[model samples]
Target: MGAGLPAPLGPGGEAVSTYLGMPNVRPQPAHAPAHPLRWGEPFPEAAHETLANGQMRRNLAHATRTIRDKRLRVTAELPDWEALRDAGAAIKHQVMSELPALLVELERNVTARGGHVHWARDAEEANRIVTDLVRAKGADEVVKVKSMATQEIGLNEHLEAEGITATETDLAELIVQLAGDMPSHVLVPAIHRNREEIREIFAGRMADAPAGLTGEPRELAMAARAHLRAKFLTAKVAISGANLAVAETGTVAVFESEGNGRMCLTLPETLVTVMGIEKLVPTFRDVEVFAQLLPRSSTGERMNPYTTLWTGVTPGDGPQEFHLVLLDNGRTKALADEVGRQALHCIRCSACMNVCPVYEHTGGHAYGSVYPGPIGAILTPQLLGTGTKGSLPHHDATASLPFASSLCGACYEACPVKIDIPTALVHLRGRMVEAEQRRPLPTGWATAMRSAAAVMTSGSRFAVAARAAGLGRVAARGERIGRLPGPLAGWTSVRDVPAPPRQSFRQWWSQHESEER
Candidate 1:
């Protein structure tokens, strides 16, 4: 463990570094939160560590800019892109309202077609179900198709304890797995690592890697391919997460850039899928809307390289045995809130992450969730929840996530489903303040905010404070103040603050009106 860093207990009950080997896993992140994403450590401290890495910042800047540009180009090619986005959001909204009925119908249809449906209210149940299914198939190892749900349940760690190995087949995920690291991006797990770093990881970890591996992109990809091909051919069971599960046909969709998902789904004899309860669409037509939105918004492609959909077992082709695990994990609680439930509409296009400034700087591990970026800031806290009166109580660091962003709404503009991320951030902040009221006396930021609120509530007091702020010119150099004293120094340490004007805006406007009169 790093010096002075606290060790969080790992899934196997062993003491591990706060960061573990993987970037996202915290030692023991609160009293056993069910989801893989919930870690109690505040995001700010972790962000500090990532900020110190010049290479990480460079990698993220290039990758995010590339993806963002491509997405714009492809999306502009379509006249109905906005319409498709709106339609996608509406379809998901409908799914949330009718989720129960849709789920039951999906289960019935899936079961009738020779599939088994398992309902898991939380992460533990989902892991147990998958582990037991692998055991039932008499398999010690399973190949994976890069499912977010499995990561949510921390299934790989659980399987390891049960003496099972889960091989990740996606190229980025392979890099992450071989490096014993957590995924840093939804679509690109090792987006933090450049080609040179990838070459190092492959050369060190992959025994079959070419003798003289180079840091070229194609060579790196070929190395990953060779390593994964062997796993696909011999693995008896495959596990996946669905992009969208259609209730009308009981079909699951898997969209990917590479064909690894195809190999994992077809080569294995037994296939098991762990899916979030909110991943369903009422009909395949609704899936059509997301298909258009997801590919363009996420990968900047009009069509994914592979769009695989399956309904249960397919006789002589594909996996003969199929299992569908419906996971709640805390989504139901998130749905109860009128304002916040819009988060459930996310299609995991990852457009939000691709355009996030904070994510661009800190990378995914800072959020300490399998689901990172802007969505993670809002979604992770909801999954574990603030200690609000009626909800599940956990005073973990996920609470700090609401303030992770610059309130830049680019995430919303990039979103295919139009999740109002800025609004959710503000809403969660309100909830955090309310939750603090019920706890011990406010401290630090909360106390500061309360004091500010009292000062600003009345016009006379606000004017007085505004006049006092003018005195800040004493510390100013030109129009900007480079540093500040006391707790305010934290803001100035990173970025300069503008010097307060000689007069407040309200005063200036009033004086102008009086002069005219």
Candidate 2:
């Protein structure tokens, strides 16, 4: 053990004598409470509407391309990038397998360090806890760090309904909040809006914006800074989400590009951090792996400009009161899934989203979840229990998420922890299909698939179907078929299909054999 590291202790308060390997596994909770993973329309329907927004599409394309190029450049500078990824993945895997023991150890250490630990089974529980904590401090408003966990639980809206104001300190988050819009990207929430549009938002919604605020990045940033500086100084409480939590030390860390996160961590009298259960690493040293992988993968930088870490409250320095809420809204349920569990390895880097062709065009809004893009496609469904038993009903919006990707394998390559996203996608798709099979009334998709299966099972039937497909050439203009009829029309609405060849492969093969003879 390191000199300053605390000795590992078991539940009985004595120093643990064993090697402290993976602990006895506990059964996953039978039910996962309702979460805010999905909303509004299904992915296909939402994508259709978003695809028509030419300006949004252009904005997303440019922003994603720029970020992707930067990530490639920075990652190329590391000669041991793949090794780092492997280390990060291994650390996370160990954390998940030994989660039960780690959680107890984390709670013990955090309590010893003068911080309170709260366990929340769902989003509602988490919101109630945070809201009550703020009210106890007699605070009506709180400054916030950019936190995905809070967003996943709809904490801001919940606070508003409870008569509390939550001011987002992250520039992009503030923009989204002022515009009353959902975040479109993980790293850059306002990515779907360009500078001119942002200037318009700031001028219209920001109360203290200068009379002639320009769209230049510097001007916009200064305007936001002036507005938030007052809030940072005055707020009594702050809320944050942890990028990584060390079970060994009971320490929580938040990484950010801007300095706002540091303000949130230091200036406030009370700090509340909401973190997902899966964000734990067994030891403090394990953080070294992600400290390297995350910055380059997320912001395309050598390191984050601000990385705030706190073990607990510090008297006469920073927040005097600290609370850590460990939330398991749907994590245990997701962890139970053997094949789909890999989705939990995500570090919220958003590197996969930057490289995704689908997200580049349709944007994150199409996914209809707090998490968006390729990772969202697989993560949201499992978290929402889309096709799982004893949970929420199989929602069309959540089930449709798995099919949102093109399975281009770009996400897997871009993932810092090496999550096999494509495999998880295919596995979730199969789960969705199985759920569909149980329905008494068949959907159009299921019916079509069954019919095709029957026809393809027999040689004669397949041959006849092939010949019938040739008739489709009549509807084709040259080599492309436009606007297919009836149920298939949806396929051609966004993409053109190639016209069938003049002759089937079987017929061509037969002709060639006869000629050779």
Candidate 3:
């Protein structure tokens, strides 16, 4: 362990120096409740306003469709894609089921190879561990590769509180950091902004930037490179998140399109990685499936531009010290639910969000959680639990996210691990509806639903109600009904209601039966 680093514990414990600089956002995040009960509140009203950003919608639509099409084509070429997906799922499940054991094995090998391992049960603990490790080495600055785990845990924010500056090496991440904006996309954090916006960010924020830095890819790369080069060369510590950690050799794998990760992962004197427990694979043989699945699934490439792996440390090459922080952070609870467990099978690919209509419209921020889109609907609830006031509880708020899909099953078919996203949405909806009934609703709405339930449950009652409904529809003529009163406002807010039939189905059925007799 790093000098003076505190022992790892679940939550609300004294944080050790090795786990330094992590801020506790809360003892319990809103979406992560302590119990299994469902909460009924819908998504916040802000969702509607954000969904109206036509420019962001256009950019997202263009990028996602282009990537989605390429992914489908590449994925189809594999004769045994289903089998490969099944293998990935099975492997993840097995490792998570025996997480403690695999993690122990990983620890043993890492220690033997001159690396240190730390266990963190949640986001706070993970950040603290990384920050403390960096601070202990007396390094006031650190470089970072693109790491979703680090973002989810808010590691940069933690480092900032301790007066340690962390420079992002990834171009997209750098742009997001420079602009002081939250990441809105998994693959492209700055997807909401156009090239001109990026140029503006660079021009305004970067010192010693070229006067002629255009929005061109190469030019932008050069601008970012020039800014990051000095930081990378001078920094003594680097932080990262691993795509896959091989338990057999304690090797961590990082895949990137740019060479920035290579610079961060290799150049620093001390390297600290905070990775999810679910990121482990049993052996190198498993790489064949994931290496093929990941690039195509994520970037729609046959192979990523740079795939870096390091086990412990090399005597004369790379960092002299390596520390791996294995994070759990509600993963165990997620694993406990059989139906919801498949969410752990995700490889952080943005494919689902790309094709997600709701995500395209609202962008990732409105999901109001780290995880977003179809994946967020299923994942946020599971990770945070449904009983709390967090993002998962707000899943139905967008109300549009579940209905956003044509239920075309493209997300499931597109998933590298083959998660059934539509199925997960239906399951979550049932939970939401049941929660709505369990709690107190407005008197008028509750009474109407109760009365309707009674009428629908009995044949005789339904017959009478249907006839009354038919009379009301007839009075309105053949034109579609555009409005509704009382409890129906939630449904009618975005869509017009169709008029009821002039004749009830029961009446037609009875007449047909009499004719047959």
Candidate 4:
């Protein structure tokens, strides 16, 4: 069969052939489906709300700074850090180029090892596959490894609606779940919550939490440990997301700090992992490159405390049943974009979030996705087909994400795989502008830009506008424009605007030329 052919199914409903391929082609969208990738409001409105919360800003600032500083210290230890980054980027690019073949090989190897591989074109299919798998096992509740793929699909919510409970095993994830809050960071979901808040959540929510549980880290950890231990022991099924999967050996890896992943992976009788198609590496040896880069870029540790690798299922030990759900979930759509496709190279290390000044002030909730910060700003839009025809509306929440950034390149610098996020942001911005222009009625932003263009295109018009701008000094307070009367008020709402200079550069140049003459 050709690479574009869908895999044939067997008697057990699992893919019977290795033809489960996703060719580098963009599918035509009929309409945008509602998914967990975006929600609530547009970036600017949501950010305004989040920025008003002083406690969240303080929590994010302290947590991000600590992680950022540690990452710097540990990454500086290796002289080959840049070389390793280059190698990582090269490997990912190669994977994207040869993805169809790699995926077929991966499915073939995984199936050969007694593991079942199921393909999902979007979030709904993936959730149905998992829910059916859990129902087959007669499992009412399942323990979970922290997985962004699962979060992106809103797996927990789906499970709950089906009368099945999915318990998060990661410490941070458990806190967010118990508190009924959305995750604010990629690695640290509870980054928006401080120690005292966590302690209060545990005290009120955790049934087994010790009395008078102090806000100390150790005490909080032990409380979470005790709570999750029971779930780990009793749960018959577990769901996880893969950090990296190897096509050569059909091996999947999950790198985490605490031992929760180990328990969740091992103790359960049936394991279901929902993984993005872009998470694959070509060979087992290629895992070494990411293993070196991920830890240093994420937690600032030289190595993860627990780096778990499992190949299919092993009898008489570990889970006897394993199912790997390969999810596209708009990945193929993203892949079709030559520039935006690099967003798939993200390793989920979250280095970009730590260094983003916009994210630093507003935090991940403002981005309104499970994948937040700089990565989310670019990744969410592409996944949602923001710039594509028949996708979400131009003024929708996802459309506003690209403009959330200040064009700072800190995210690109911090990325382990070296994704040029700034370039992608600019590219998406242009797409959004085009989308806006196609609207039946012109928007205020579009009108402003057209007006500016009309003035800027002529020397006389520009000179006239410059003199008019100088009149703003009448409303100035000590060389700073604190407030503006009309449409310009929004610009000065959050920041001070300097009064326009008395002399335009053109005027200054004219006077200088006269003096020289």
The C-alpha TM-scores of every prediction are 0.84, 0.88, 0.84, 0.88
Using lDDT as the yardstick, the better of models 1 and 4 is 4
Clashing residue pairs in candidate 3 are: 5-18, 6-16, 19-128, 19-129, 30-389, 30-390, 31-390, 32-384, 42-397, 43-397
Q: Distance from true position, residue 462, model 4, in Å?
A: 2.5
Residues 93-197 of candidate 3 have per-residue lDDT tens digits of 777677778888889988889999999999888878887898799988899988878877788998999899988877667767887766777776766665656
Per lDDT, the best of the predicted structures is: 4
Model 4 poorest 10 in a row by lDDT: 1-10
TM-score, model 1 to reference = 0.84
Q: Give each prediction's root-mean-square deviation over alpha carbons.
A: 8.7, 11.6, 10.2, 10.9
All models: lDDT? 0.79, 0.81, 0.71, 0.82
lDDT of 1: 0.79
The local lDDT score (0 to 100) that residue 378 gets in candidate 2 is: 86
- Taking all chains together, the TM-score of candidate 3 against the true structure is 0.84
**C-alpha positional error of residue 439 in candidate 4 after TM-score superposition, expressed in Å:** 2.8
Model 2: colliding residue pairs: none
Clashing pairs in 1: 8-27, 8-28, 9-27
CA error at residue 384 for candidate 3, angstroms: 1.8
